[model samples]
Target: MDVTVAIDCMGGDHGAVVTVPATRGFLRSHPRAKAVLVGRPEALEQAKGEFGDEFGDRLNFQVAAEVVDMDESPVSAMKNKKDSSMRVAIELVKSGRADAAVSAGNTGALMAISRFVLKMLPDIDRPAIASALPTMKGRSYVLDLGANVDCSAAHLLQFGVMGAMLVAAIEHTDRPTVGLLNIGEEAIKGNEVVKQAGELLRASGLNFVGNVEGDDIYKGASDVVVCDGFVGNVALKTSEGLAQMLASFLREEFGRGLLSKCAALVALPVLKRFKRRVDHRIYNGAVLLGLRGVVVKSHGSADAFAFEQAIYRAAEAASNQLIERIGERMAAMDGVQQA
Candidate 1:
């Protein structure tokens, strides 16, 4: 297998500056893989300049007249920006022209285009963006990062099943544990949605591990944490901000004086490694679960390396039969009727 990936060449902060080089680097490492770079023809040409003969021969591009802006609303933008690169790239996957699609664009627009073009898997009410977060214990899957803001208890149960399947398949875990995002670990805690969803998940025959609090996200209390998009997105952004703040605080503390500076020099490598582990960009991107095809969302400000990581994550999603597995799991759940 040669997996074909479609990159939204014009849809990120860095545009093709990051996408083109990332494609080049991915192809260099994954010789069997191919890419369809979707964007305005001239912008892609300029970005393609860096790869010279190597990429000129290996790559392909599909022209899309427009690029989705970062600030656009999901539903309205997808309806209006039909010629957008994100829309075209997702269309490629839906049409079987590409095995997967990757983008660092407007999260809302990407999710909308994905739902419109690729549709959801059988029995899935809404697709979700699931990310692998590095934990002190290791890593865990957190779903509905920004996909469905208003979710039902049934939806959270679906997330648990699908997310568990994702971690088990892609991460090579056997019977990955599942948890509900809540204010406390007690079964009686959380809002009505969490409490009701907890009941469903506990009875759903999956490996449900009760509830986990916000602090447990990186403590590895569970392999999969299920929540609605609104909460998950807040948690994700808060984690990112905290990670950056902590890194900056450490740097400032160490650079205060000569003795501290000397200690900082000695600790630089370890600190840098730790920072990389916490930065979500290092983990970079994740697959949008419950869709008919693999769709990955990279960091909006992703660089070439980050884009490359996103591509790799997309490939893993495809190879693991993520869509198929999620469908099977959701179908097995008692409440979700197969459509």
Candidate 2:
């Protein structure tokens, strides 16, 4: 198989109920991809019974004796749940048994276990959570999404490099444009850290666009947007909340009166298209970048389709040699510095 993702079958809200069905759906779509179910064997029994012979060799299982809880502490989990599905899945990636690992478990725990197990890629100081968000033109990748709450100028530069490489691997682009998230379009608008980050990005050999305002994200100002985890996390949560509010407003408007109900019927198709465009479920996967191995974090409450998207994301990263590409870029930077 070109790519094999270890699935944390006992992670997330629905555990095997969602992950198993999602894996089956992902396998059907990606014929070249294989998946290893990692969880308590009994937890995966029903899944094995349902799709055992359907994919046969394309699918396998790695029994994990324990399961990590949704509210578990990273330290507690690591010390107590070594055999947890989440840890075992990451272990598969570290051991080369799997090219990537997909999980919809506790974000902090997943990040901790992954970093502890896989370690950081050479010269990458910290890992970041990167995800694609819908824009007016298309979608743009954003990084440091709640991973490193506090970051230095160098960390932001590293985020830009990793974010660019992620876009390169997934979008097949050689040099994706990168932008700094700031309060204003002007370089002097943000704080000292952002100002220093702007300077570093300018000389980093990547396609560095100047500062972009909050509204510029949806405007598709750049192919990738770079920021520290604090700002990135707030932006992400705000966008989700905004989408929900808008949807609620639309429902309330449509139900206001008979006249509005008639208008809603007339605009039903348009509304459906709009809903599809903004559906958070379609963009459920947030990749943990800068790790030695590929790891994707699915939203904890994701359904089968949303979780399947996460699996597909993991497969794409592995097949496209994402880790190798990022490593090459970092190596090139180091070589330039040495010269």
Candidate 3:
């Protein structure tokens, strides 16, 4: 197998019911990929019986006694739940048994256990969450999504580099453009940290775009967008909420009357096309950047199809050598700074 991923099977609301089927789908779609289903044996027994003969050695299992709760505290999960599915999955990455790890569990616990197990990449003081978000042009990868609430100019610069390298390694784009999330396109628009980060990005040798307003993210103003976690998290949540609200409005309007029902039937194809374009499930996995290993977080409430998308993302990053690429980019930037 070109890529081996460790998946936390006893994670998310549906647990094995969703993750196991998703693993089956992933293995079917990715012939060159292998997956280790990590969870309690009882939860994975049926999966083992079904896929064991089908996949042979391509699919394996590692027993994890405990499961991290969706609301569990990061500290408690880190210190207490040593054998939790989330922790065991990450451990596989650290031991080189898996190229990457994926989990649809507590985001906080996953981040804590991941940092504790895999550690941060060299010269990377902190880890930032990065993910691909759909845009008008195509998609743009944004970083620092709810990882660090407060960030310095240096931290923002690091985020830009990591985000760019992620796009480069996974998307095969060299020198992907980076944009600082700001209030305006002008240089003097945002806070000092953002202003300094823009200057750093401009001089850091990456294809740095000047500044991008919030709406510019959907405009695909740049290939990668960098912002502090506070802003990034707020922006992400707001977008999600807005999408849900618009969808609800559409449903309500369509069901209002008989004439509306007829209109909805006539417009059904166009609505489906729009829904497919904006479906969050298509972009289900979030990359935890700056870690020494590849780790992806799937939405905890994801269904089988959505979870499979996360597996595909993990396999893609592993096969593409995302961690090594990020390290190389960081080292290159350090050399420039020193010279």
* Model 2 lDDT per residue over 106-168, tens place: 999999999999999998999999999988888899998998989999889889989998888
Predicted structure 2, TM vs. truth: 0.96
> 1-339 in candidate 1: lDDT tens per residue?
368889999877988989888888899998878888999989877866766678554588899998888888887777788998999999999999888999999887888789888988877787888998998898998988988899998888888988998887678788899999999645647889888898888888888999899999889999999999999999998988887788789889999999999999999899888767666666887778888999999989999998899988887777777778877777666453221
The better candidate by lDDT, 1 or 3, is 3
Q: Could you tell me how far off, in angstroms, the CA of residue 195 lies in candidate 2 after the best superposition?
A: 1.0
Q: How accurate locally, in lDDT, is each candidate?
A: 0.85, 0.91, 0.91
> Between candidates 2 and 3, which one is better according to TM-score?
3
- Error at 330, model 3, angstroms: 0.9
Which residue runs of candidate 3 sit more than 4 Å off their true CA positions? 185-188, 335-339
Looking at candidate 1, the ten consecutive residues that score lowest on lDDT are 330-339
Residue lDDT tens for model 3, 1-339: 399999999989889989999999999988888999999988788778767688889999999999999999999998899999999999999999999999999899999999999999998989999989999998999999999999998898899989998888778887899999999645558998888888888889999988999999999999999999999999999999999999999999999999999999999999999998888998999999889899999999999999999988888888888889888888889954333
Cα misplacement distance, residue 7 of candidate 3 (Å): 0.3
